[model samples]
Target chain A: MNLFIASLAFSVVTAATLSLAAVAFSLQFAVSNIFNLAFGAALTLSCYAAYFFFSIVGIEFWLAIGLAVLFSGLFAAGMSAFLVGPFIRRGASAFVLMIVTFSLGTIIDYGLDGGFRDNSFTLPFGGSSLAIHAGPFELSGAQLVVVALAVVMTAGLAALLHRTRLGIAIRAIVDNRMLAGASGVPTRKVTTVAWFVTGLVTGIAGLALAASTSTVNGAIGDNYLLLIIPAAMLGGLGSIWGAIAGSLVISLADNLWGVFVGTQYEVLIGLLVLMVVIMIRPGGLAGVISRGWGGT
Target chain B: MAYYISTLLVLFVSYAILGLGLNVQYGLGGVLNFGYYLFFAIGAYVGGITALGSDKGRVPALFQEIYAWNLPVHLPYPLTVLSAVVVAGVFSVGVGLIVLRSVRDDFGALMTFVVFLTMFTLIGAYANLFNGYIGISGVPSPVSNPELWYPILALGWLAISWLLVGAVTRSPYGRVLKSIRERPDAAAALGKNVRHYRLSVFILGNCMAALSGALLIGFIGAWSPLSWQEAETLVVFSIVIVGGRGNNLGVVLGAAVVGVGINEAVVFLPAVSSDPGLIPSVQWVLIGIITIGFLWVRPRGLLPERKAKWPWIDSKPGEVSEGNLLRKLRKGEARK
Candidate 1:
């Protein structure tokens, strides 16, 4: 029971980081209509940026987080304006655009490899851990923080999408960009905002991932890149709630399977689940549920 | 000078083989196989271990020489190449059966990536399997004489690969693959087995990739899991995309230029500073630039494959019939 509980707790922490990347991934797909393969590399670059800031400028971890987010957003904006935007202007297919992003990812990956000398960095997120006893479940302060942040971010995103003017524009653009443009919404500007926010989330997710693992390597992005696409697709790439739900499902599936099969095969099991889900319902579990609910 | 050219010559042929295989899959078949490195790894290891001999249940770790089997000398050299192709082909089919069912193109690509990561992680972690990071070394070379035998071996393999590519591209079956790419639904509606066709082409293409890996490993005389990274797949992918995806000639040219040109440049170029990572980093950047340039500019490549004319050439069939037996032989050789 104790081992099961420990594993469940770890799964939640993993889900937290995955949810951030998955949600951002879903949003970018929702608005831009590009799958954004480069998002993983962007997350990697952002984490490295935060690591650099912490090591070089001696900033607090929280401050480093903010800086990473800023840089990610700015960098994303630059990529959108220069790299992705130009290709879109030329009427390139979304698939072609995705490849372009991948090239950019390759560039970023090797650039980091060159800059950081292909070494893994250790991000020390304080030395102490507070343990909590709630009924039969025990929680570390870091794990608690991860879960809390996930909830807060999800809620904040929900509120932002539901309440904001930009969010309305984003929704309109996603549905029909030409129609949205005719309605006086700046689709391009909205896209840029979506890219920036997506980038920020990618940075935060990377930092969270780094903190959770306590080890940041050059292939950090490469390691987790597989998970993001699955989660995003499983959540129905354009749906935020779908992404959150997908993350939870993937996390739980991995954890439950890991209990019986072992941790090494957890990803293998996650992949199995992805295959099953995609086979049965390509739109994902949440996608099916939402569509049914909306239909009625 | 001969040795240097031979080295480049062998690498060019090997990568061209790889590029052609990928071009068939991604370009002709529209199957996004991002984990292509796995097939290459499979070929390399299968060929390496077959030649290196297997280790019987020996001591675990410290004295552990896992699963080494000493075979006859002749058996290790050429036959292992066939085994490599077969093993990699079988693996590709199994992978295709499982992951290729119903997924988005990008999702399929991601799954391939996951496969690559998991497989690589396992190989890296388990020393019992292929000796971890130490890799399989001294796998033995194909040629006896450096200058004479190497080029002979290279051109022999190149001729074989080109013949294979030519046959596939010229066949009515090739048209079916292309039709599947351009219109999956129509092909499916017309009674073509969509999944089966894809799996077939995927398996064949992977066999070619594996064959290329076998040749490459034998030339280098070493095999490592790191030798076939997921990033390396990107380079081959760029070759296909930039060289004109479905065009064989373009793919070969693209492979020669990107694979050989940039690689040799990096190999021979003096490091301005002592940062050892600069070479690979710069090479990656060059690959990125070339890929992006193709996406932006001449994506069709310099020598795109001409549309297949039914009369075998633009010249009428009667004119071809007028040619003598020698001319026919020459034409057949050119076709080969």
Candidate 2:
């Protein structure tokens, strides 16, 4: 029972970071309708950027993180404006666009691999040893911060989508791109902004992940896709609430599996869940909710 | 010097087979199989283990656990390659049945990617399976003088693959595959079984990949997780795109240019630093750039697919073609 509680606490932390990434990923797909395979690379780019600022340039830790997050947002916006926009304009099919994004990811991933020439780096967070206990759960200071960050980001995103004009524009675009354009929404500009916001989310998620794991590497984001893709997919591709709910389920399953079974097959178990989801419920949890109780 | 040239030729031939396999699937059939390397890895492991036989004593201590199954039987050279092809074909059939059922093409492709990652993690985690990360080594070569004869053997396999793919591309079945790629709904409306065609092409293409893997393992004398990275599939995709999708000749040229040329060209670069990974990293970045650049500049590739012409209609000059006549009649009827 103690082990279960400990795992539950860890699962919450994992779900927090995972929700941020999954929501960001889902949002990108929602606006552009392109499955941006390079999103993972964006996450890694932010982590590395933070490393560059703090370790190489000798900036303060929090300041470096802030700069990294901003840089990541701009980078994502630029990718949409420069790389993805042109290909979409040129009448590339969905599959071709996916290949294009995948290629872009490869370039960024290997570019970092070449530049760093090292496998892993530790961020100077200096909070791993500081443990805190609340009720039956114990989490480190960094994990608690991560959980708090996720909550704030999720609330901020919900408010933006529900209460703001830009959020409505994004939702309009997602509903029907042609209809939204006919209704006088600046489809392209709004999409770029959406990309930027999601990029910011992606950056925060990357940092949270790095803080929890204590190391960052080139394959860090790529490996995280094992969890992020499944979570986002389980939530339904483009739904924000679905992303959060999906992350919780996936994170809980991962931690519970690690506790009950061997830890070696945790990734395998996550992937199996993903396969089952794809096979039986490609529409995901959101689809089920939208369809009502008796609808298939 | 001869040995070096032979090695390069062998590499080129192996990649050409891989490119042809992908061309059949992605180029002709329009199936996006991002996990294509999984089949190649399967082929390599199966082929290597079969050749290694059941002699656990000779195997490394780290990998001796694999022989506990006592099912690794030593086969002749031809039988080993055949077994690799059959195993990959069967596995692809099973996977294709599930994956091809996806309603969306991108979803299917993503599933393939996930499957590849799953296998990679599973194989790496299970020590008894493919000896985990250490992989299998020290398989006997088929030919006595491998340096001289192996290149020829690999070339022979490539020729067989080329001929097989060529025949399929020119046949009526190939045209049906092309139609499914162009307009799947239209093909289905015409009573063609699109799913069946995709599954068959998927199986055929995977078999070719397996053959290429078996041939490669025979020459390299090792098979491991390190040998078949998930990214390796992109290299084949690059070959197909750069060569020319749906064009066999262009795919071969692509294998030569992208596969062999870019790979060997890196050797001429002056060592910038002692870091062993720098050059390969740069090489991959270059490949990514080239792939995107080609997709942008020449989407049809250097050798685009030629328009299929009917000899019966084109052979007679100054004659009204049946296709044009039918269109003219339809236009006339519409006016009435």
Candidate 3:
């Protein structure tokens, strides 16, 4: 029972970090309708960028993180504006777009692998010893920060989506690009802004994940996709709240499996959950919810 | 020099077979199997295990202790390869049935990729299955003079694969498969069983991949988790894309050019740095660029698929093939 409670607490932290990336992924898909298979690579790029800024350039940790997040946002925006946008404009099929993003991911992943020329790098978080015990949960300072950041970001995003014109434009584009364009929403510009926002979230999520893990590698983000994709898909590909809910469920399931079964098979269990969920309800949890509420 | 040539030949044949399988799945049936290498890995593992025999004493003591399960008997080379094909085929059927149920083609592709990653994690974690990261090695080669006979054996297998793929792609059934690839709804409306055709192609393609793996293990004498990373599947995709998506002969050309040619070319480059990983990383980056560049510049590939025409229909003016539109315009036929 004690172990289970600890696991539950750990899962909440994990879910908080996971939800950021899942929502970002969902938002990207929502706006572009492309799966953005390179998303994991983008996350990895942020980690590497932070590493570069902190270690190589002698920047402070917090400042380095800010710069990394900025760089990642721009990189993602550039990818949308230059690489994916042109292909999409040329009317590439979904399969072709998948290949394009996958190939782009390969370039980034291998580029990092070659440039780094090391198996793994350690980030100097220097806060592993700082732990906080809240009820049954024991979490590091970084983990607590991650959880708090998630809460603040989620609330901020809600406000932005509900209160701002840009957010409204993004929502319109997601709902219907053609219709949004017809309504003079400047669909392309709004979509790019949406990509940038998602990229910022992805950067923070990657940094949080790196801080928690302490060790970073080229494949770190790629491996995290094992969790991110399932969470995003389970939440319904385009629903923000669905993504958050899905992340919680997946994280709980993963932590529970690690506690009961072996930690080694946690990833496998997550994937199995995705497969079963996809098989049973192709539209995901959001689909069920929507249908229940008399939505098409 | 002779040995190097033989190795390259075997590799070329192996890649050719893999390319053909992917061409069948993605090109003919429009099933994007991102986990194509999983079937190949399965074949290699099964083939290696079956040939390794039940004698624990034959292998290193570490492997003996690490491997949870062992085949009870040592099968002959033919039977080992056959077992690989059969096992991979069965596994593909299971995966295909589940994955093909997704309404979206891209979703199915992503599921296949997820399946690959899941299996990769499973194999790496479960050391008992294939001895973990150390992988299975030390299977005796069937050929006494491998240098002389292995290439010949590989060529024989390639010949069989070629004939098989050729027969399937050239027949009337192949036309239906093509129709499904172009327009699944239209094919369904025409009374063709789209799902059945897809599943069949999926199984057939996966079996070929397995056969290639079996053939490869016989030459390399080892198989491991490190051998079939997710990116390796992209290499086969590159072969199919660079050669020609729907063209079998073009796939062979692609295997030679992209698989063997680029690989050998890298071997000759002067080492720029002491880092052992640099060349391979750069090579992969190059391949990714080439794939994207080709997709953008020449989507049809070096040798595009020939337009199939009905022999009974009389020739009609101004009915130019898609690929020959430029030529038709150059010839001033559009004015008529």
Provide TM-scores for the models.
0.88, 0.95, 0.94
Total clashes in model 1, counting residue pairs 3 or more apart in sequence or in different chains? 7
Query: Lowest lDDT 10-mer window, candidate 3 chain B?
Result: B314-323
lDDT of 1 by residue, A62-173 (tens): 7887898899988988888788878887887655776788788888988888877537887776523676877666766776777788788888888778799988888888
Mind giving the per-residue lDDT tens digits that candidate 3 earns over A14-68? Answer: 9999999999998888788788889899999999999889888999988998999
Best by TM-score: 2
Scoring only the A-chain of each prediction against the true A-chain gives TM-scores of: 0.91, 0.94, 0.94
Candidate 2 residue lDDT tens string, A181-217:
8999998998889989998999999998888787788
Question: What's candidate 2's DockQ score?
Answer: 0.52
Clashing pairs in 2: none
List the candidate numbers ranked by DockQ, top first: 3, 2, 1
- C-alpha lDDT of all candidate models, in order: 0.77, 0.86, 0.87
Give lDDT tens digits, candidate 2, residues B49-146. 77777765645555556654456557889988999999999999988988887767777788787788788888877877778887889877789999
Q: Largest lDDT belongs to which candidate? A: 3
Task: Give the winner by DockQ: 1 or 2.
Answer: 2
Residue A82, model 2: lDDT of 89
* Candidates in descending lDDT order: 3, 2, 1
Name model 1 segments beyond 4 Å from true.
Answer: A57-61, A127-131, A135-138, A288-296, B1-3, B55-64, B68-76, B310-336
lDDT of 1 by residue, B1-336 (tens): 887888888889888989989887887877878778778878888787676563433122432355343332334567889999999988998888866775455556556666777778767667676677777776667667856686678678878988998888778898899899878889999999988988888888899888888887777877776687667877887888778878888898988888998898887778857588889888997798889888888766666657655543335444645334345675785355
